[model samples]
Target: MNTAVPLDAQSRRALLQRISDILLRPAPTWLRIDAEGTSAAQLYKNYLIYLAAIPALASFIGMSLVGVGAFGMRLRVPIAAGLVNLLVGYVLTLVMVYVMALIANALAPRFQGRRDMPSALKLVAYGATAGLLAGALGIVPALGMLAAVGGLYSIYLIYLGAPVLMKVPRERAVAYTAVLLLCGAVAGMLVGWLTALATPGAGLGQRGAATLRLPGTDIRIDAHSVGQASRRLQEAQREGDGGAATRAATDAIGAMLGARIDTGQMDQASRQLEQARARGDSEAAAEAAGSMVSAALGGKGLPPLSAQQLRAVTPEQFAGLPRTAIKAETNNVMGMAFTQVDARYSQQRQQVQLRLKDLGAAPALAMGMASWASSTSESEDEREIERSYKKAGVAFREKYRKDGSRSELSILLPTRVVLEASGSLPIDELKQALQPVVQQTTALARPPA
Candidate 1:
């Protein structure tokens, strides 16, 4: 609730000095900060704003410009999508700092600490300095994992500050820190989920490469060399040789910033595409186009399927139920295309619905489902049983009622397709009906011929 006051040049220098003191001599600095009269608004306007931008801007450059290397290739997110992510992430981070402060204030009384808003804000904002500064490592995508060390150090900073800022006894600081960390972790996950939803293809640490291509020309920028250079840079850093690490970093940056097109490969591809077009070979032409699209999308998506292809795989009946209705559609958004099919079946009082969706170009959705692939869980009560687990390398979730009046099943295929079945039938029967459809759809997931 505290208001901001105008800060002059001298005040700004003192604020900057606080960062080094907090990092190097946190124990004494916490006492000094506890006595300061700085308001919440001033802390945010002069400190947190700039501190939070470090990670956001670093991530933007890392993903949109520097890119990541995988499978001997370099992949960068399209600049426009990266910009959106940067904005969303930056705003969310600022809010998260404030939320953590609020949590600290609320939990202070339980730990025998005073509930003071300004003190709580100072504890969080200053404690986050190490992690925020370390965000610069993101400028080199492959080294991003190293930033976790900074986060671990930040937890120590908070632990040092808790007794001074919140008036908690030294003995209770550890318990307070653990609870605060658990809350921060949950908030971080929520923020990540929201950011992914806002920017679909802007997921961090995404694999694959994107080639630079002109619309009506054969010119292309191959990033394979850049990818190789980045790997070497990572190795040099790991060896802890300062000179070698600096040189490798420079080499990697130069490779990415320089225009190094492979003329011979470009000419060969152009010739093959021209030949396919001149000969009226539609299949060959389509295949060539599909490859280009895949490269542009970080080498992860399949070409759009035709309406006939989707309809052909959709089942007309399930088990002994008669088909009631069916629908298939392809939707294009932001130059990316995906398909979905829906079908309904019924027999007297029994009914079922099935849906198939392609996740080739939907990286965010695919990443969300991929988390389930490595996890297992199950729970049951008197009326129903629910379980989630991986089978044959595929992720599945199922629930069924004891009376057999309702059941549902969801399967995430390795090919990035999601199949769902729900209705009045038993869960086992629903899974049985989906076997044929799953096989056909998996076959259709291959690249265009």
Candidate 2:
């Protein structure tokens, strides 16, 4: 069969139906059909290119139309930037498909499978049918979570196709699949890193010539001006110069205000400012000033840090903290590292809440005299490690409370990597309780020896 021919109307219909079967039917049937070799070029043309486009186009439309919903509010990406991201994501997917196929072919012999490039390509392309199709739901925004189910099913497809397409022995299929998945995980991380640098919405460290319109003024600020102003503010705060600090902070706040407003709206605001000034509308003037002050005080819809708090907070508290630890990109399973470990004594609760993240794989190392609160024999100990193909993690709880009452639990989820205990027990005790699970996760992250 000549798989090189471009897909026509009938061929396209047949191809779609075939993919439908691969998703719904047992792996044995799809593998048998896929084993009948198809050309890499034709496969890319007929399936990979179009299948990957489904999510890219869907995301573009979704962000442009429905937007991302968070806490009952719709947050939309700029259309131009969204389009750029969509195009970049689509191209990345195409490249990754080829890269994964090459990896599969290279790994085939190690698993005692035949080294067939065409089979490898088919394995990836056809195997991904479930995910690519389900990604179409991204257009709805809210239904984006459904795409994860498709991804899980794709993992099942990979497990099933490995023995048949890779020609690996049945006994070695699981081991072979695991290595293949590890390679994929690494590739995903690299792609995400590159994408972050390319897309320009919230990336902070780049210098650009674009100017931002201030809330109530005709003055436009450039990136260099913003940086200088921020540094001056920091210096003033450090020097304990209250007058200079206030002035510097005001400038930074004014420049940073109206971050969410677009260029057109900013122009409108400028016009409104002039009109209000001409009419002597003190109310409008006062409202604009309040917005500028709020934006300066962490009112930009993000976590706030006041001038006083900024002076007190230092990087020393969060030294050696990682932004992200274990993240399965395709699975959307991410564990963020803890930063700035802290503690506070709650008078009403009569307990010290020691806030922290996993401590360099040694949760119990510095913990002082806090013993394991829960014994495996304890009825409340119900500690069962949750392990699955998609995830492997644990949850730990302290056995004893200082108050001896579970009436109020001080839950600390600084990052997804967290330990919870609701007792008058010292903070170290809570850290100690979480040590086993953190240690287990560290072990799980290691490659099979």
Q: Best lDDT goes to which candidate?
A: 1
lDDT of 1 by residue, 311-400 (tens): 788877787788888878777643457677777788888878777777666443343334444456677778998777888988898889
RMSD values for the candidates in order, in angstroms, are: 19.7, 27.7
Q: Where is the poorest 10-residue window by lDDT in model 1?
A: 212-221
lDDT of 2 by residue, 90-134 (tens): 777777777777878898897679898888888877777766777
lDDT of each: 0.66, 0.48
What are the clashing pairs of model 2? 373-399, 402-424
The RMSD (Cα, Å) of candidate 1 is 19.7
Q: Find the 10 residues in a row with the least total lDDT in model 2.
A: 366-375
